[model samples]
Each structure stands twice: as C-alpha cells, then as structure tokens.
Target: MEENQLNPDVDYTDMLSICSQALDFYQQHGITELIHAFNIANILGTNQFYAEAAFFYKVAFNMHSKSAGQFPLAHFLLMARLVALLKGNFPIKEDEMNQLKGLCIPLYNFVEGWKRYKENGDALSAIRLMGNCFEEFHTGEEADTIYLTIMMDLFNPNPEICIKDRTFGAADFNVIPNNLFMYWDQNPPAEILQNFEYHKGLTHFNLKIFDKAEAIEWLYQNYGVEARQIFLSARHPAEAADFLRVHVINYYGGWWLDADIKIQSIDKFCSIIPSSYEHVFLLTHNNVVHNDFFGSVPNSPILNDCMLSLYRNSYLHTGLFIAYKTGPGIFGRALNRTFYRSLRGETKKPSVVLLNDRKFWSVIADFETPYKDSTPHWQAS
Candidate 1:
C-alpha cells in the first residue's frame, strides 16, 4: 500500500514488487468487481505497464458501462481506456471501438480518425475530424496534450523503428552536418569539460562549445534580433540553452547534445543512425520526445515549428514552466504539426526517426557533474 502511494524515487524493481502484491491480493480475495479491476489497472498504469493497464481498464469499462449510475464514472472509465491505448500505442479492438462510438461521439470520432490514419498514412480526414473534438469534448489542458500526442503517434511515418534499421556504415552520412554542439552558461566544471572532451574524441566531429556570451553573439549575428531577444529573456540558464540549441541546429544542421552527455562509443552511436534521416530524436521513458539530445538538417520544418513555438510561448506565457514553454512539450507539439502537414501533402513527409532509451543508452549517457546538487533545478525553483 505504501508502494502504491506517490513516490518519485520508486524504481523499476519496486514497481514490480508492488504489482506482484496487488495481483496476489486480488487473486487471494477472488476480487472480480469493476472497481477492483480499475484499481489493478491504476496500479499497472502507475508502474508504466500501459498495455496491461489498458486491458484491465477495458475490463472495468465493460462492467461499468452495463450498469446505470447518476455519476459519470462510465464516461471517466471510457476516457481512461482512450488514454491507456494512446499511451501504450496499442490498437483499439472491435468491441471497444463499437462502445466508443456509442458513448461519446466526439471522442469516438477522434479515435476513429486516429485509427484511419494509423491504417493508412493519410492525415486529411484525421485533421478534419480533430478540428471539432476540442470544442465538443471540452477536456482540460492535460487531456488536450494527450490528444495531441496521440495525433503525433498516429501520423508518425516509422512509429516502431528506432535505431536498428539505421545500421549504415561510414560511407553513408545524413544531410545533417558532422558538427557537434554543446553549451554551458559560464565556466563549465571539470567533469562537464571532461565529458565534452570525451565525446569530442569519441566522435571526431567538429565540436562547437559555447558560453552564454558566445551563444548570444552567435544568435545575434546569425538569426538577428528576435532570436537574440528571446534568448536574452530566458529565466534560467537551462532555458536559455534550450532556445539557443534549436536555433543553432536549425541554422547549421547538426547534432546537439547537452554538455552533460557522454557518448559510450562513437562506433556504436554512428552505427545506429541512418544516413537518410533528416532528423532524429530519442523518446524518454515517459514516451515524450527528448530534447536534451537530437539532430536535424538545416531548415527542418519540425525544428522550425519548435522555433515558432518558442517564440509564441515566450511572448504569450512569459511565466510558463520551462518544459512546456521551451522544452519537450513544445518539441512534441512541433512533431504533431509536422506529421499533420506531412499527412495532408502540405509539406514533404519528415524523414524523422525516434529511438528508445535501450538503444540510446547503448550509445551514450548523462554524465552528472559534482555540481549537480548545487545547481538550481527548475522543479526546485
């Protein structure tokens, strides 16, 4: 029960133990009730076992939908079903699809649009259907974010392939330049510097390291006043770096790794990327596209979308959190827009690839410096 309570420090092993306990408790008590099924689903969802969570949610929904109640518990359960499926990237089954159609027309339409897009790489119908869901469904920001993520996933050209198919040798290279970039606000500590040099030696790529002043000067000279102003307005050094990295990569297409990243092996890293990809990113454990390290070709539409999002989020929500304002949240939104445009034939389908942590860790890792604890985290601030 203690494990079921919220604790950010809970590790994978702890999650497994909690799941085992919950399952055993259910089996021992012969609990086959609707709420019990939903409770198990919640446990699984909390542990990041989304597919299993989705199955149990489905079971709960079937039970709840059959009963009539004054409360909207059935509606809540149905929404959970949608969230679980989207997060897990699992397909909707026929019975579930039929139930969705009967309960909430707007959600059903959006899910059906997702289904169509997933089945065939067309986005026009999906886009059209998606237009009306927000006005009709009226879910809050959190649900909207999930819906947007689902749209992105449905339109992804290669949803499952991360790095395995990208085993191109030294002869082939991406349109993105061989240059590597990293930044620190001021004098980087010894450990970070060591990480910088290590990655440089590993890749043998032309490395461009920047301090705050240098970053500002580069932005001013290359992108003019608007970019320089946005960079200047950043609340944290991390926020400033976040804005600058996108501009740098979008202007001179190449790889951008955080100063703290250390590549494990150059050969393994190089072997995983296909030369044909215009852009590449890694999906974090929570399924959001990681912004800490990624690559792009110059003038990539997706990166451009990110830049636009930064500018808009900066001017509109000046006090917004860093992640949504200039980090992975904006990046994921950009992916959604680019994928939609690609589906509608409005632009060239982005040649983007997304890898998971398994392949990503096989290549590189976050090298924490001694100053990590002393540094001000956004969450702490």
Candidate 2:
C-alpha cells in the first residue's frame, strides 16, 4: 500500500482487484479483528471510484465502531468520516447511528450531539464539538492544524448562492437553468470565449463567464462578513471558487466546468439538455464521480443538500479540510446520498445522469493548479 502511494506507476484497477480479494478472504475466514479496509478505500478513492469506496468505508467504519480496542484503528478516524460523508449515507440505521454516537465516548458525545446541533441550527456548539474531535484524535501540531482549518471554514463559509429561485424552470426553458455558466478567475484567452460564443445553446440567453469579483460579491451577500473577508484574504483566489460554484448552480442553474474541460464537448450538447426527469448531469471517471465537467438546472435539492452535508461533516471529518470540506468528495457524497435516498423512496424525481468521460474529457488540457497549498478546487471551477 505504501508502494502504491509512493510509486507513480501503480495500476489502480489491479490494486482494487487485489484489495477486493483481500476483503473477501477476511470476510470468509472471520479475521475480523485483524482486518483493515482503509487500504481498499484509499485505492478506490484515488482512482476516482468513490461510490464503491464509500460503500466499503461505511461497512468497515461500522465494523470498527462495534469492535473491541484490539481492532485495527487509526489514531484519527478523519479519513473514515470523510469517505462516509462523501458517500452521503444520511438517515443511517438506528443501530449505526447509535454506534457512531458512542464512539467518541468519555471525552464527549460525537455524532449524536452534532446531529442535535444541526437540527437546532446552532453553529457555536457544533464547531466546539468539532474542535473537541480534533483534540480527541490528534495531538500537537496536527491537532492544531486540524482545529484551525475547521474553524476557518465554520467562521467563514463563503456561501455560494446569493439569490435563490431567481428565474427559469422546466416550463420556462427545457432546463431550469437557462444558460451555461463556467468559471475562470482570470480572463481566458480569446479562443475560449470564441468557442463559448459559437457553441452557445439556442435556449439560453447569454454565457456568463464569472471572475473573482462577481464570485466574491455573490458569496459575501449570501454568507456575510466572515466569508467575504476569507475570500479577499485567501492565498489564491481559487480557494474561494467552490463556495461560488455551489451557489451558482443553486441560484442561477446551468453547467460548471474546470477551465481544463474542453469547451467543444459541452457546446456540442448545447442543442439538447437532459430529460425532465434528470436533475443533474454528472460523469464518473474510473468508477468515481468527477465533476470537472457537470451541470444542474436551477435550485437543485441535492446541490443544497451537498452544501449542507459539508457543514455537517466539518466537525467530524475536517482533518482534510480541502478534500473533505470543500472538494468533490463531499459533492460525490451528497450526490450518492441523493441517489440512495431516491432508491429508498425519499425522492420522487430521477437525479444525476452519469456521463461518459471519453466523450467529455477528451484532449485533456495541460494546466497547472492555480493553488498548490490548499487545493481549494472548484471554488470557481
């Protein structure tokens, strides 16, 4: 497993196959106490096979929760909670919830109390509990870093949607969002805009290319003072982009694309939108959800849920602030939760259309990450 992480040449498919076999062996032989499932989840997650990895993480986490102290365990269960949040397994079974509630025993209650805070809309107590989680599982600098990151996000969410339910619905346009919205912090070379202009969808009004100022204003109005300060003071403007990305889709409706996502692919489909039943257009690469290129009409319930789930996870899984609090991990978790809930008869309409990567991500652009330290990706995609 260390080799896989160190070596750049590892084949993810083969790694997953090996891990799956190990899981089978562990299950059949009843080597419960000795079993560790993080390796499997790690491999799958790295390769973008998040949904499957989430399923495994959930089972392993539950098993670990029920085990005696002899079971394989990490000093901090941050990763476990992260993948679980990404899985979006909400409204968990009564027994599962109980196990989670009791895990942070003696120090203080964990999930159970967090759930109460969420229900009551009490941010202060919730953040306090999250800080306690950091102290409980980590120490020294690691604990300090974890606590600070969660507190920053909690203090300044940089809310995405400034205006809700502005205009457009299925009746107004084939898709509720009437235009294609892609984000770029700096102005793109003329060519990108050219592609956008030429390939504009017939049903839409205009292509709105958002930059840092627009994103900042929208989020500031929606999320308020602390969020505005964070966006302005962020090391890189892109760190605040995901905050804006969620708000754009939630408020205006339409697609969001990484600058690297080719314009032609989305433009080609401009003539057509997903059927009325489909609420979102997402794609999975290597069996994991990849939203490098994705779309939603307007005011999608799952997008709101995804935003909410992120805060819910802040206290429990904020160790990897960039990945868990603000990356596709939570987005995938929210999306997975939406689909799972729908399967259980919680939602009526069909949600998410998984697309083909070969079609959308062809000719992958060579682009450098705008921000290296935080990897605050998709803040404005």
Candidate 3:
C-alpha cells in the first residue's frame, strides 16, 4: 500500500491491506505507534469503512486510554467517541463523554447537542445551538480556526429549512470536476455509473472528468509539483477529491458539480437567479454552506486560500481536517474570511453571490447515513 491514498471506491481490498500494515506497526512497537493506527482508522472512516473505523478506534483507545485524560490525547479521545457514534456504536461504551472535565463553551454545547440529535432527530436544534456557540466565540481566522463536523458528512441544510431572498437558475457555464473519471476499468461501481448517468445528459457541460493519473498530470502541468504531491499524498479517494476539486477550480475557474447532481434542472435554476455577483457563487439554507456544488472564477482568492489552508492542515488527522481541509467546509471558511476581512478593510471585496439552497445538490448524501433505516436519529425534513 502507498503511504498516502488509502481509500479506493472500486474495492476496499487495497485499503484493507494498508490497514493491516498500520496494525503491524502498532503490534511491533506497541503504544508508541498509536497515532499511525488512529490516522489510518480516520482515513478508513472518511471512506465509509465503518466496521474498520470501529475496530481501530477501539485499538487506539486501548493503547492510550490511560493518557486519554491528559492534555492532547483528551481531544483525540473525545473525537474518537464522536466518530464511534457515526458508525452505529452508541451510548458510548464509557460513562463519560470527553476527558476534559473543565469544559469550554463550544465543546460542551457540541457534545450535548450531538447527544440530543442522537437521542431524537434534532439536527437543526443541534446545528442552531452550535451556531450560537460559534457566534459567542467567533474567531475570524483566514481558515475556519474552529473546526468541527457534526459528522464527517457535509451538512447542507435542505432548502425548505429556510426561505431566501434570492435563488439560482443555470450557472454561467456548464462544468463538472470530479475524481475517478477513468480510474475504473470497463466495470466500475454501480453507484459511480448512476451518478454519471444522472448528469451526463447535460451534454453542454465543460466536463473535466478525471482519474488518478489525469488529475496528477493536470496538477503537475498546471499548478506545479507541490499541488501534485498534495493530491497524491491523500489517504483516501475523498481526500484526493477534496484536494483536486479546489485545484481544478483555482486553475480553470468554473462550476464544480458533483457527479450526482440532477442535470435536468440546471438551466431553470441558473435563469431564475439573476447574475448579481460574479467571482464566486455559493448556495445555502443554513448558515453553513455545503460543498456538494459550488462555482468560482479562475484563480479567485477564495479558492487560493482554500488550497493554502489544505496544505497547512495536511498534518492534522482530526475530522475537522477531513471536513474543512479536504471537504466542502474549507470553501465556506475561506469565503467568510475573505468577506469579513474586506469588511474590516483588510482586503478587496470579492464579488460573490449567495443564493437559496437547491441551486445544486447531490441527493446521494443529502440527508442520509448508513444508519438511516435502523434509527431515526438523523431524519431529513
């Protein structure tokens, strides 16, 4: 297995091999090799290897359980508990939630709100409480200095959740930037083909479909060695997607549509929403915008900052890095920092249009998780 790039969608055999290697290191060196196992587990979970994530979380916890209450390990332990919730391990095996007895406001609200959501389907309530906590302790960093994911999944609140003054029609241009364009052989995953068919009908799109090789070449030729290295170093397909998606936009400057978008309604969404803002366009019903689908002009500051933040946070193994750095979370954070900085006269104002939700969305992950049928914890409205 490669040092990076663990998640492969076509099959998990490769990842399973990598996990075994990580486990080997732990077995050979004992607790000193804990972080390797922990980081690999995180990579597996991000790629939806829930069963593996559960197993590794247990292993890591056992290795460092004694030090869990100490300074840095506590934070990781709390996060481990949260991740356990994602894969169906509930009411957490331990009696305590996190090791930090002296809690911070955001951390307290986050843990409590998550419990509420888990107990009853209260996503909005949990989100609202978290939002309030953030407002109470707003830290305006270029990146989302405060990183948290209710789950590694993106929380693009359904459009019906809130009314908006403006909505979207068709985007200025048709473009689709995604991973694994030709990575698969003749037989790809059924889900991959389904997503492709859903949007390929929109023939006019400037589709920039890519596989691992194509993406690496594009990065090397266009952006340079560093970007290619970053893309190649990702521990999973999603991580590669996370890194490459931003680079494609930063270099080409166009709409980045998920393969699962319903292409049939693109024109209507674009036409109805008049072009009021130019450089970048984002949509949302909730305060936090999602990365499912968004557009930006070439080389915009938003995409640039996003790329930079991803590079800076590459070392972090937390869910926040997966969410913000390699996921849709960074896009909004970068935009917020740019906009807020302009407000404070720190930078020039960017021409960005914020539209009502449903401008573009991928229903595959819209409001669902693996535990959808067995539980009622995260039902969509």
Candidate 4:
C-alpha cells in the first residue's frame, strides 16, 4: 500500500503535545533561544521564574563563549549585568560579579568606538550604560566628567591637531560648529588640547567667518553647480522668531526659486524655496498647520490680527514654526508669542488653541514642525 493511501486523521491534542515537547526540547538545548528567556526575565523579575531565566542566560553565555569565542560576550555581559544590578543591594555572587566586571572594558571600548565615529545613537546608548554602571559602582562626578569629556573629544568638530588628510573638505561644508569648537580656542579643555596637534593637521571650514555669498558664487562658478544654503536658528520662541527672519534673508540675499524636493533633501529644499510666504514648503510628508519650519514668518496685518487675538485671550503654544515671508515684514510675532506662552504653561489649552487656528496658519501647525532628532544636531541643550 502506498503511504498516501494510508493517510491518518489529524489529532489536535497530539499536535499540541508535540509542540509542547518541541518547545521543551528547545528550552533544554538551544543556546540562542535563551535571549528570549533573558528578555522575559528582564521584564518579569526573579520572583516570577527569573532565576530560571538567569540560569538559562548563563548557559547561553557559556555556550556562546565556547562556540563563538568573544563575539557574543557584549550582549551576554549586558544582560547579565542588568540581572545582577536588579538582584542587588547585598553582596552578589562572586563569580557573577566577576563576570560583570569583565564586561566593563568591552562595553567601554564599544562606547569609545561609537564616540570616535560620531555615531550619535550609539554614543547615547553607551552613555546610558555608563550611567548605569557609574551608579552601580558609586563613581564620583569627577570620573563622570572625565568620561564625558573623553566622549566629547571623540566627536569634537574642531580638534587642535588637524591632520592634512583629515581636514574638512567641500563635502563637510555644512558641518556646523559645536560648543566644543567654540570653547576649544578660549579655554581649551585638557582632553581636547591633548589632541590639538592632530586637529591642527586637519583642514578646517569657518562658516561664520567666510563670506557666504562669495562661497556660494565660487561653488557655482568652479563646480558648475549651486549649493543650497541652510541657516539653523534655534532659540526660545520669544527670542528666536525675530532672529530667524534676519538670518535667512542675509544668507540668501532675498532670492526666490522653485526647485524639486525629495524626502531626504531637507537642506536643499529649504535653500532653494522662498521663506516669504504663509506656507513654506517642507521636505517631509508630515503636514503642518503653520509655517514653523523656517522658524518665523514675516510680520503682516493678518498675523498681527491673530497675535492680537491670542494676546487678548492670553493664549500661546511656545511651538516653533516655519513662516511665510514675502518681503521684509514682522507678521509672525503673534505666533511666536503664542508658542512662547504655550511653552511657559501660561496657555490653558495649548494644543487646541495653537493648532486649531486656521486663519493665520497653513496646513502645518506649530507642533508639526520637524526638528532635528539626532544628538549632534543643533539644539539649545
């Protein structure tokens, strides 16, 4: 008889039993499967089968060391460290503590690599881990400051030692000066000064000192191309709204042009597009009710009327926005005030008041503006 002719009826209970047996087998034998067990233990503490989970993690760690060498050590170390920390306040198991201690160098090295590469996300992650470890070790603020300073040096834009090959090129034209650069020449931190010789060897681009118009013209003339200009002006809504208007016009010399925009072409879009309008174009798919993307719009009677209404009602959102600027005018002050009031918690109904207004705003609301999300990006903090 053919095997197909002898087909048996399916049994749900047997199938479930088989699945349970397989899961049990996996739990008993599979080292890779322990990550899930560790995660579960992390979420649900030792009182709820976490001891078993920790045991599984330990087994997985040992298996990883035996099979993959030190490749998986960082992950296992982090997991074990978290478990040890959580189960603490008393003396931990000596072997477990030693294992956690062993992870410190590798973790620190990983963080150092991130800082050197200016990987903002990784740097932040490393900082978080360092902070946890510091707390566990009761490390003093002085040690923390040293660690932070070291990390900052790894990512500093203006190091004293500028290697010729490492100098800023045309591609790095948009790199903005950070607090590190501003303080480097004045009260050079010891960490930065140590690498000053290396920074000096690298070429530098001084955007603030260079003639921007000439630079733009030169790039166009020599390279047969035009570069987009982006002016990042960040401030408290009360102060920055006024400053952004002057900055944009001064940088671009009051030229308006329509250009193709892509999702990734934010700087390019902002440069070619005119800011003198009620609705400034954005290089994002997200909608905005106000032009907060450019910081502030030109002042106008319409905006003045809206400002008057908001002031009379004592309403604000303290949200920054891109504004519509047709010519030299200060029409968006009310919107700025609105945002300032909202931020100060002076406005009772922030979201409804600022975002619901349709007369003075556009599709983009003040809250809808896309601010920089990266750690190294511009911010007052």
If scored against the real structure, what TM-score would every candidate get?
0.65, 0.49, 0.50, 0.22
Estimate the lDDT of model 1: 0.71
The segments of candidate 1 whose C-alpha lies over 4 angstroms from its true place after superposition are 1-128, 131-174
Tens-digit lDDT track of model 2 for 183-220: 66666555545545544643344567677778778778
Candidates sorted by TM-score, best first:
1, 3, 2, 4
Task: Give the range of the ten consecutive residues with the poorest summed lDDT in model 3.
Answer: 134-143
Candidate with the larger TM-score of 2 and 4: 2
Give lDDT tens digits, candidate 3, residues 1-381: 122222223343444665665455444544344575577566666666666665565555555645535433644544554545544544453344544224344655655666676667565566555443432222222113222233212232332332233445776533323211222212335565666664566554555567778788888998899878877777656667777788877777666655433344545544543334444344454435556566666677877877766776675533343665566656656765565466456786666555444643422234222333443321111
- Between candidates 2 and 4, the one scoring higher on lDDT is 2
lDDT of 4 by residue, 15-125 (tens): 223344434544464323445434433433333333443444554454453333554454543445335333432223555545545666544443343343343544444
Q: Give candidates' CA RMSD values in order.
A: 9.0, 13.9, 12.8, 24.1
Q: Pick the candidate with the highest TM-score.
A: 1
For candidate 4, what is the lDDT? 0.31
lDDT of 3 at 55: 58
lDDT of 3 at 264: 44
How high is the lDDT of residue 146 in model 4? 31
